[model samples]
Target: MDIRQLARGTVPWDRLERVATILARRYDRDAVRVEFLAADNWLSIPCIVDDEWFVKIVTKQHTRVHALLTAGRNAGALSSGSGGFFTRFETPLAMVEHEYEATQRMREIGCNAPEPIEAFEANGLGVLVLEYLPAFESVDDLDATRVRALAPELFATLATMHDNGLAHGDLRAENLLVADGDLYFIDATKVLPDRQAAARAYDLACALAILEPRVGVRSAVAAASEQYAAEDLLDARDFLDFVRLRPDHRFDSTRLRSELEKWAALSEG
Candidate 1:
């Protein structure tokens, strides 16, 4: 199936909710929220079960298409210039299984990650339900002051996770949440198995990039650096060279890189 073609428009609510019956068995039908997420290449939908839990469905088609697209980036799915599109479809049951396992692994290793409540197939679609963190707030909602205040704890969470040999590959600001004075990491699909320092730093850098615009590069870096040893900490500078080259990040790279270079020089002095 051509996931790109199929995802062109909003999918029919009824067509997508063939799995609602499964949800109704666990949650009130009236309270359930079926949201078809946008901007993703996959059929990503979540059934918000009245703020109690979330039933996340990642279709087999998306899982396969996503893999093909990744391979296409190098092999060229259709044509070298096409930047091509390769799609695949699989049994829905297999789609959510990997994520479910990953989440459990993170939780097992003591990271504040979500745990699976259930994993099953519904009407040929793969679904994994999880414990919803209703009180958590996205990093996007945080201001410079809030970010600075919590920077230490945030850094500690990443550092500790890194020290333990697990990496949260998707540490986007939104994926990091604060609730009740602690941090919670979500979206565990990309958790890496090795304890490579570079991978850990990459996660820290991802969060810092998102925070840079909000807290200013120096303040953001300062707050985060305070918690970890600068000797071998996850240096945002390393990732900056490549990350800032992207269009969205270019505008701030010069200023951020300058501040970082100054910081490095001053620390050395």
Candidate 2:
């Protein structure tokens, strides 16, 4: 029961058909029963590839885009006035392969990252079959009370990732899905090791703002940050440039900084 299924021809049927063929040949299953669990630029098709699985298929067109993106990243890294930005470009297939490696390493580090069951190049696309999370809900639909309770755990998970030198560049409510009161992260295209302090701080600040919809902005940033610091993740003042990036809602950066200053002074006293 997928929204796109009802509205056929809405998404790229040609791409799905092509990927389905590849899956059928690879898994020795019927492509006719291929169903999408979820998708964005990449298609998450549900299939039985020796067992229950969600196959994430990335199209060749997207890989070409990744190549272009890699070029851009290299240029940006070279042109960056400071040593803050990194310049590593990966092709689409390489990207999926790298993600698989990162997942294994992160698991060893005790971080909650999804692992791929199978990863390879197929149908001119990067095919990554991964273990799907069962019975989970994004924080967006959760209430303020529930979010407040989970807030500390969320920061703790982030702290673990940072301690191991990884940065989940995108930390939003959607990317954080809770199952049984624990957190698991997804969409890790930007997750990398040896990340800068600024990048890690950005992840924390954005996470606080993401909780704003569930809790008020100031309250979310302050409360979560208190645990974020007390948990030895980071000092609140480190998020001096804390600002909500989503233009739909404006959370004042100046107010955030001033509030953090007071929170720190009070903590010291």
Candidate 3:
């Protein structure tokens, strides 16, 4: 079946059947139903087969992004989280492809990230199918200890990626997804190339600064931060800045930024 031809405007039920049949023939798997899912940065169509797997046919732009991102390079910053369409940028395909690739690379390095199944594009639609995670709820549910636990793991993963020459420029809470009771970094459009030491330090510091306000020094957060710092993956100033930036439980960005600047001065001094 011509995936491209079948992927025209709105796929009618008959066409969907033909597409499923083609997929079964090509991938050697039986499919049950095809339904539309969320379209955050890329258009997503979830195809449910047997109990074992589901095929998410993403648009072509997203597919390209997954491929590029896995190579460890800067695609761009992603505005979306695990939810729905968040940001708009050119080269949707390239960004999505790189994002998927970066996440896969992170998992391979023993970092916490979603498991990628397959990514491809046919008929202007790019797609990536990944092992689904069930436990993660939302960013708001996380507390200080959780953040602390997550920070080190995340930093370690980022360090590994940097060692291999990959960078995720946009490091925020929303971009992280909890799956199977573990944290996994999801979006990768902002991944950079070459792993500049100073840049990594700056990025990590900024993230810490941002997280400081939210998680604070709850014993868990403090312990996690100390462990991560021991890796020499983060600079003292950055870590301090992170501590300073921890947000008030009320979720105030302005106040957080104000606090970050104060720490920034201390770091500069």
Candidate 4:
């Protein structure tokens, strides 16, 4: 069995049924159809209800995994010469509640995100519901040319988030989805309120890492420059090595650092 499967753990059939029944009662439906997603997610068991709501069922094990990941991320932040900015939740409900609030905040600040429905606990499990996107593709599924075209917009969105004091503590290709030719952000993690600046730089680094392999370091840096200053790009540079350490991201950090330095020099000249 895959390690991710073991880490994600499992939700017993009876408990899951109780969750579904609660959802049905809350939505005033006689019954609801639940489709479990085969997502490679470590923190939640995702599903669709009645093809209308996206649901995340969080277990105690999920909360424990999140705590571990938060610690690891904080350690990475420390390596970047900054104090840890990532926040950890003590319970399953807190995890979903944070995501729900984060998503709502993103949409409130003119960022594109799915409509958040509600977050609640049922049968000792945390359940978050949001409007489901029936037709969409993750950024990872797009071709290079398509990604190149969307690169600037991606940076622009990140800029909007940062300008409003928001940070997507986690940024990866899979967390970005494109529906109807519009970009949508999802699965934002919690960050400490006072450490947003560091989180911003980290977010920028992750974005650069995501685009580097598909669009090349130069193009990635170029696109980022459209929304971030040369200094900001350099600040993001500090987190490149840290971002590379994540299992989800793979890029030529040395080349990215070189390109960022070149871009800064050209901007100063």
Error of 1 at 212 (Å): 1.3
The TM-scores of all predictions, comma-separated, are 0.72, 0.72, 0.58, 0.98
Candidate 4 stretches greater than 4 Å from native: none
Candidate 4: 10-residue stretch with minimal lDDT: 2-11
Candidate 2: residue 261 lDDT (0-100) = 64
Report the C-alpha lDDT of model 1 over 120-177, residue by residue, as the tens digit: 8776667888887768787767777887787777777777777767666546666778
Model 3 lDDT, full chain set: 0.50
lDDT of 3 by residue, 68-138 (tens): 43332222211111111122334434444655686787777777766776665445444555666645654
C-alpha lDDT score of every prediction, in listed order: 0.61, 0.59, 0.50, 0.94
Model 3 alpha-carbon drift over 4 Å, by segment: 1-22, 38-56, 60-96, 143-145, 190-206, 217-269
**lDDT (tens digit, per residue) of candidate 4 on 1-269:** 88888888988899999999999999899999999988788899999999999999999999999999999999988988999999888988998999999999999999999999999999789999999999999999999999999998899999999999899989999999999999999999999999888999999999999999999988999999999998999999999999999999999999999999999999988
Residue range 1-269, candidate 2, lDDT tens digits? 66444322132678667766876777776653555654443222334333456566655445545555445543433332212333232454766676676667667778776666777876556677777665678887788899888877787777777777776655677778887777777755453345456556656766766765666656766666544563222332344333343432345555655655666566666
Instruction: Write down the RMSD of candidate 4 (Cα, Å).
Output: 1.0
Return whichever of 1 and 4 wins on lDDT: 4
| TM-score-superior candidate, 2 or 4 | 4
Q: What's the CA error at residue 24 for candidate 3, in Å? A: 3.3
Pairs with backbone N, CA or C atoms under 3 Å apart (clashes), candidate 2: none
Stretch of 10 with least lDDT, candidate 2: 80-89
* Top-scoring candidate (lDDT): 4
